[model samples]
Target chain A: MARVVGSRLGVGLALSVVAVVIVALLSSSTRLAVALGLGVAVLGVGATLVSLPAVRRDHPVVTRALISVVVVDLAVVLTFRVSATSNSNVAIGAAMAIVLLGLSFLTGSSGQISLGNGAFMGVGAFTVGIWADHHATTPLVVVLVLATVAGALVGLVLGLPATRLRGPYLAGMTLAFAVAFGAILNVFSSWTGGDSGLQLPSAVVAPHWLASYFGPGASTLTTSSAWLADISIVVTGVALFLMANLFASRTGRAMRLVRDNDVAAELVGVSLPRARVVAFTVSAAYAALGGALWTLVNNAVSPSTYGFVLSITILSLVVIGGIGTIPGAIIGGIIYAFSAGAISWLTAHLGLNPQGNVASQLDGIIFGGLLVLTIVFAPMGIAGLVRHGWRRWRRG
Target chain B: MDSFLTSRNVSDLLGGVTSGVIYALVALSLVLIWRSTRMLNFAQGAMAVFATYIGFAILAPSTNYWVSMAVAILAGLVLGGVTERVLVRPLYGKPEINPIVAMVGLLLVLESIAAAIWSTSSRALATPFSIVDWQLNHKPVALSPFALYEIITSLVVMAIVAGLFQYTKLGLQLRAAALAPEVSRLLGVRVGRMLTVGWMLSTAVGAVTAVLVASNFFTGLTPSGMDGVFAFGFIAAAIGGLDSPVGAMVSGLALGVVFQFVGDYVNSNAIILVALAMLIVSLMVRPNGIFTRSAQRRV
Candidate 1:
């Protein structure tokens, strides 16, 4: 126990030192917000390291949350100091990670297939879009909350009947919803903003106090977008932390038991329907939260963006990034973010037309191949593969 | 007023029949796979779209519709065989959901390949037969030539499939292999080859649907042309009992007419939601399927 605590304390101190190096590299002219962020992260790390021996064994989840908070705090400040484009890129990645987390929980733990999560996300996005159309003055937090509630309601309604379904039947319903999303959007064009999509009346503006802090006398970070990135990171961080705890909770265990063997789960008195419904509803809420955050980064929502292809892509990425794991979701999101850039770059160099179908579909091909390979070779995904390799190497 | 009602009602009915055959054709393909593997081929739509792309390529150079269709079916046979052998073969005896997910991956890969070769732009395929609606007393009341072509083709294919399953030795072996692989193997049924042939025949059926639908029912030969059709067919397959091909045909046609009425009377956009509702309600009410008599669960 002493040795293990010593190692964790050493790792925590090393991370804090790296955090200081990153803080120093950003220069003194950077935001006081950055310094304040650094101070908080370091203090958190210090506090957690001190509490490691006490809480490490008995309250591992608390230990994990503390570590995650420190990581997120440092990341928020680092992303804030980056260029506007990279900041926006990070923001998009963060939002997608939240969505992937939802998928990982539903698919990885509960073992339900959902092809309509894109549409569910659309439910959240359009909540923001349609709500803003009618009530432009609604506070962002209230709108986000409403978006989540809207998604959960939709999930509950859909999930209740779906709980009785298995495999193809469940997938069939979700696939139908996904394929029909565009048609549904077109029906209420006035509210959904129709084909053209809805633009926020204003960009997601950081508040004045935040602007003053983030502006930092024009040290290269655009005030609002960077602040938006910061907000996105925080939201993503909270999602990560919450999902992690859920995975370690009794409900998560029940869902997993239901996934592995329904008969066994039933024998244990776990209500199969309730477990399935809870997984479905919770997954939908996470997707909605991710979608609501997307509005912050993109400032617009379109029907075309939330179609069957997007849904498939989301699933494929989850599988490729390692389904059913929190780290897998984040890894998948990062892979998606980077691969988009890489594909565009490769297509440009290869003389492929950007608007051409082949160039557009390159990512699909890569992800699809990876998905098939992952399922066959490493059912747990890239994270599983890495984890396996790490364990083998450690033994060697 | 009487003429107006008859004209609209008859036209909608004819239209429903036309689309219903298309759905039945797709449902037939799905039922074929499900009977053998107990797996839903989510890539069935994408595979159909691919065969259509190949058919379009053939028809583009020469305006011979039959020749293009023959070649397309041949293409589907080869593609399906390859898919079953390479991609799907590894997934057997695994979790039930793996096949579905892998097929989704195949769907993406196949659609992407189709797009890479033919592009995603929509284009109309030329129908050898005319599309002018047959009329009675100066009011359109029946099927057009192309619509008739679609129904006749589907009927012929359905009949041929039924005959093959009932009368042929190969079909008997295929059935035995799917029904009892261990016993069939002991009896020298060549279970592996049967599965490959099963997929080949199934995709050929889907190919026929794709080629025929390109005449009147399908929008155009786009990469996503058959995805919507796939969903409706999935509903039909579920209603028909995934194990029954005959059930697929009847339920598919019935669903087509009912789905048409919903689109015609209600908002057309509501069609998908209606499809989803039908699927969910049916799955909940009769998980074994409406057309099925037995409610046996396979472990």
Candidate 2:
């Protein structure tokens, strides 16, 4: 009986992997992939829960961590469902938050500080927008892939020279890259709308059948919202998976070693500059991929969406989430999205005065407070704090 | 616009510089903060905007613009000192990014506060000094009092600041503190207090620029009035080298002149693009800035 049960579980996992691969290849619709991703995410959570009892006896910490994540995911899904009547917007928000989280996790863990995400996003948005609007010829999947590739190439070039610079210098260089890219876009006003940004096409959504399936009770959700949720879920899930896989790889280990001590890493046969470049490249790809998705959702990409403010906000989210941890990034993204969405909703529904419109300046206050407070009190970040609490609970 | 520029090309160039000088002042203020704390005060522009508004409010109650200007400067002094003590003091020994993030936060707070308090009405600030047209070398030259003040005051401030830093004990101490914080601490120097003082002084300088620039621009400065300053100042600061006070002064004037020429020749917005280009070139060719710091890494 035990052997049969084990075989069945293995088959389930194998089938899930096959399904994922199939989805990745054949799907042109971001919405479909997003829907599939959500289903898989749910399945993953459910399976993890089922496995918890078995793991709890041997690897309590791992089991507990998994359970905690499931709980967090539940909270997020619930909050998103409550706030957004449509699955698409919620998905989009989730996807964006997830992408940011993944990128932050990669960056913080790898010891890289880049503000080039803004630039990468700009590139992706414009590319996708142009391809979709002008040619209307490129398949959706093809466009997304192309956007990521372009972003990656740009990131790689920027990363090559930039990796040589460290700390503040690298940060400054990335910032320049972002600003310069914006300027270039403006200079070519005919194409990019110069000071007046170009309009993006309307966001494409999931097919009606798929939307109805997952959004069973989502009578309140709009078609746009459903589509957004679907795409966000898929992209975020995929990015997280890739990042997680990377972290478990030899390359990721090497990157971490380089981050901790470049001199020591060099002594151990790691090329510090190469590692930095690799980290940067990975980060760039993530940003670009995320940017593509963002444009697809907004259906209108502009320069203003990806500026210093967005870069800073991304940085703040990462820091707040716990800098270098996967869970930290995810949680941080959710918190940010929730706070931002809530403030915006409140401002509109309650008809608050502009002065009280926390959304307008809430970012500054929250990030500012978080930064200062984190430096002083929680230098290890939210993930680190969670780890600390878990250890304490176990000890007790 | 072309005819307007064609007729007053020289004067337009001068006018751009006159405005550019204000950017230089704000940039100079940024340099002071960076030198002392190795962190760019992203809030510097916002702080100046806030101070300028306060000056405006004070002047609003009174008819005399000069009196209002004095009151504004004083308000700036107080505001600068308080900001340093409350927001900056905690971030003194933290990692570099901490202060930057905090400053971003401070930026939000200041802008929001301003918006909340002042509402969104654009107040047309009265220029304290009127424009006077004077003939120079067979050409009519238009000179505004604000222009004369900016040129004169910037030069005077530069000279006085240079003298103070080069010759004074406080300057010596501040330099020592910036270069070797641990040694300075060991030497019984009040490094923290000195930093606070640096913030206070730099903020006051920013206030002076704000009022002057606002008066010249003839509009109540928005949260963004100082944005152009921040960007241009960064250029000047970089070109001057982040570490050199004299370099800042020269770079500021040079930037002013460059922008004037750019404004005269290219699109006015092109000046900002030029500034952005300057940053890229400087980072590539001379990351230590034009002044060339031999000791630092040039990445």
Candidate 3:
């Protein structure tokens, strides 16, 4: 178990270092490259030392999780500070990570498959989009809260029937929900801004007060891109922390019991319906939060963005990240971010015309191939592979 | 003049039934596969679209609709058999939901591959029959020669399938294998082979539906051309009961007429909304499905 934890940390640290290197190489600024390179060197040394045979095995799961969160947060911030063009992509990936974490609880713990969280995310994005459009001065925090509430409310309503449905039936209902949500957005074009979608107000950086307290030079960090990245990291860290705690709770155990065997769970006095509903509601709220963050990052919300494709992609992420695990979700997010970035870089450097649709087609192919390959060969995902390798090494 | 006899109403009714036949074809395919394997082939639409594209490619060179349709059906049979053998065989005895995820993955991969090969733009396939509406009492109605052909083809296919299931030895073996795989295996029936055959037949049906519907119902051969049709077929099959082919046919046609009426009287965008509403309401009222005699807990 100790070796597993160490190897997990080592894997994460190596991924972060690779991400930093990629950002540094992609950026045009020499200063950014030097800073990122130095950070990578230090992180590399630290990770190596920790993974050494002499390292102590006294760290608890909570401590390991905290260390992961801090390392990932720093990596995200550094990546964002260096690359402006890819900031939105990184932020979206982080938001998706948070949503995947939420889904991991439901799918991993409760054994429910939801393809409708995209709609919940859409609701969250539109909540923020509508608010920012109508009242541009409203605080981001308030908007996020409202979005989360709206998501949870919708989730509760959706979860009612979901409690009875299982497997394909549940999938069918959620698929209908996603389809209906998209149609509703189009029908109520006056509010959702129709198929063209709604443009959000420019995302503001740190409020004037916060920036003033940080002194004059800190204002540079308040750029919309930088601020969005910072917000994404903070939200993701908090969500991961909460998710970890939830997974360790009694309710979480009940969820797992319900997932594994409903008959057995019922015999033990677990309220199956209530557990399923709570899981659905919480996951939906998380999806909404992710959606809200997405809007903040992109400064827009479109109905097309939260369609069946997005829903399937989220499912694929959870599966590819290792279902039901927080660390898996983070790794999934990082992989998503890097692959998207790499695809864009390849397209740009190859001088492929974006308008010709080659880039998007290639992106689709990669994601699809990855999804199929992962499901077939590595059902336990990247994290599972690492654990397997660690066990083998220890045995030797 | 009676309001019910209005030309517009009659036209809408005709159009609805016409499109409903197409939906029935796809629904029948879905029902066939579900009954045999107890798995929803989410990639059915993509597979059909792929076969249709292949047919379209043949059409461009040969300009022969019959030849192209035959080619498409054959391609669908092979593709379906290969997929079942390669991808789905390993997934036997896994959790019910795992197959759903795998099918979604297959859907994505197939759709992406189709897009890469054919390009994303919609391309029209030349139909043998005229797409123009036929004359009715000196007025143009919604019924076209092509529409009539599609309706006839669907009915014929369904009849053929029904006949096979009722009268053929192979069909009996298939049914027995689906119902009791272990028992069938003990009885010397090739259960695995039957499952593959089921996929092939179902996929061929889907391909036929795609070919029939593509020219008129959709713009043309695009990666997402069959998505809406797939959704409607799913709903129709669900309403009819996933196990009942006859039910799928009836519900699909009924849904077609209802959606046509909605499109005519209400907003066109509300069609999917109405379909979803129908699905939810049906599931709530009769979880076992409207046609099934036995209520099986699918979850």
Candidate 4:
């Protein structure tokens, strides 16, 4: 008992040192510095308090402490630094979070992987884009709702066939659907704006009470970006929370049972096909919802943007974010979102792009290397690593 | 309507026959990989494109198209053998998804490498054959020498592959290995070596298809230089059975006819759409392909 307490105290002290270094790095502008420092101090104290139980032999509390610390850090970043005011990237990221949550809910909870996520996103985006284009007078909420419903319906239809197939067969079938969708969308150019893409109306704020909070002298931010980001994050968070809770419930148990052993599930009087269909339907809806959220933010759609490459990237996101974890999806999204910009920035910083053909081809090499390395080294992805660290810390 | 008759179609179907011959040749490459590895080599078209580009680089100083074709096929042989040895060998016996993902990575890597290795500039390739006039039903029907060569070469290659697979001990060993690698290994067959040979042969076949078709229609080179032929080839292979060489030939020809006449008669833009629809139908009705047995899941 004394040894456990000693180790926990040691870990707490080490984390505090790390926090102090981070604070020192970010200690620049007065307002930002104070905010970040306070946040870190609060997190340090909270971590110290959370570890007390772990020091006394409650092993699970260590995970709880880690998750809480991460949650707090994310909250601080989102609230303080990543201003929803006129920040399109934040809005896009928030929308992606919802989609990721939905995907994690459907894929992780249900034992299925989808390769047609890009297509489903396309459907949602296009549906809303068309609605906004045609009914310029319609309320933004109505258009979004309609798009969501339409996308979900289509998702259900696509998922129907998938109930019978699993693993690579299912993925292959979805891939075929996605390819066909891309081709068909390209052919039906007038409807989907062809290869050029369809433009959508920017999301309207609808003049909520939250917009009034900035006050008279405040730098005005677009009501739409703020409201949309909040709504998407909140809705997606709630949906995912419900999904997680459901997984901890009987329905999730049944799905997991079906996934683990179909014969055993069948013997238990569970309708294997029905459970699969339900899981598929739910997953498709999540994809649709994510797509609609994506359109709401982009306010435009392109066939080329939602093709095979996008599908592959989305699947990569799910893979890299631990196949079955919600936080993993968010982490994966953040990584993907930043990776492109970081690579471009690094290339620019080194004057690499102007360095001729070698510089230009580096992007491909990097991406290929990333794929190979991730598959070979971290099969369970970033989430798996996090879990591993958390376990080690607890043991220590 | 009169030309739709089988014998008459044979005469008026010169264009279709030429295109189909090229498609069948490419489809043969697809089949070789599918038969041996049981995985569709989606990178086949991209590989061929790279080989053709290499050939183009080699032939840039002169207008010797034959030498370019030969050199490209040889490059294809080397490339296929090397890729299988290095990248694909590790992926064997793994889950199908792993290979698919790896192949997608391969496709991207190859495209990026080709773009880097060769300038992104589109080059117009010259064909060895000249335009010629032929008499059919008292009408002056024009037939290019390149198209005629494609047909002749395709037939010859088909015969060669058939003979090699049927009669030669090497062919027997390859078949044994492809069907059951364990059994073949027990029977003293060098399965790994056979796969390498298979890869080389398939890649060479792809190279021939690339040079012949690219020379005929797509003289320009880019990342997507051989994309059209690949699309048509995939359609042909899908239409025919993925496993049957004969089916590949017939389906390639059939797809070519559909593209030529349907685009001529209907909206030319609808050709791809129609092809996609045909593929969807084929997949639904005969997912094992028109010639191969239905695929069975392991577990």
Evaluated with DockQ, which candidate comes out highest? 1
Compose the digit string of candidate 1's lDDT tens values, residues B1-299: 64764576766777888889889999999989988888899999888778878877745666587788888899899989999999899999988778878999989998888888787887788789988877667767567888888889999999999999899999899899888999999999999999999999999999888877665764767888888889889889888888888888998998888877888999788887788778777877887678888665655
By the DockQ metric, which is better: model 1 or model 3?
Answer: 1
> Each model's C-alpha lDDT?
0.82, 0.67, 0.80, 0.68
Q: Per-residue CA lDDT of candidate 3, range B44-95, in tens?
A: 9999999888877745665688889999999999999998999888888877
The candidate, 1 or 3, that scores higher on TM-score is 1
Clashes of each: 0, 14, 0, 2
Choose 1 or 4, whichever is better by lDDT.
1
lDDT of 3 by residue, A317-373 (tens): 888888778878888787766777788788899898866666668776777777777
- Ten residues in a row with the worst lDDT in model 3 chain A? A53-62
**What ranges in model 2 sit over 4 Å off?**
A1-88, A102-112, A153-161, A173-183, A200-222, A266-269, A344-351, A354-367, B1-16, B58-63, B131-143, B217-220, B296-299
| Worst window of 10 by summed lDDT in candidate 2 chain A | A72-81
The full ranking of all candidates by DockQ, starting with the best, is 1, 3, 2, 4
Query: Per-residue lDDT of A267-364 in model 2, one digit per residue for the tens?
Result: 99988777877778777777777778777777677787877666666766777777777887777667765665676676678676655535465556
Rank the models by TM-score, top first. 1, 3, 2, 4
lDDT of 2 by residue, B113-214 (tens): 676566546666776566564555545564666578777887776666667678999888888887788899999888888888788778878888877766
Rate residue B76 of model 3 by lDDT.
Answer: 95
Which candidate, 1 or 2, would have the higher TM-score against the true structure?
1
Kindly report the docking quality category of candidate 1.
Answer: medium
lDDT score of residue A377 within candidate 3: 81
What's the TM-score of each model vs. the native? 0.93, 0.81, 0.89, 0.79
For A1-396, candidate 1 gives per-residue lDDT tens digits of: 656665655566556556645553454365764776587567758867786766677667767766766767677767756777777877887888888999899986678889888888898998898887788877777888899899999888888876778877788778888898899888888788788889988787665664465345644334666767778887888888889889988999988998898889989999988988999898889888888888767889988888898889889888888888988998988876677778889999999999888898898888888888888878888899899999999999
DockQ of each: 0.72, 0.26, 0.42, 0.26
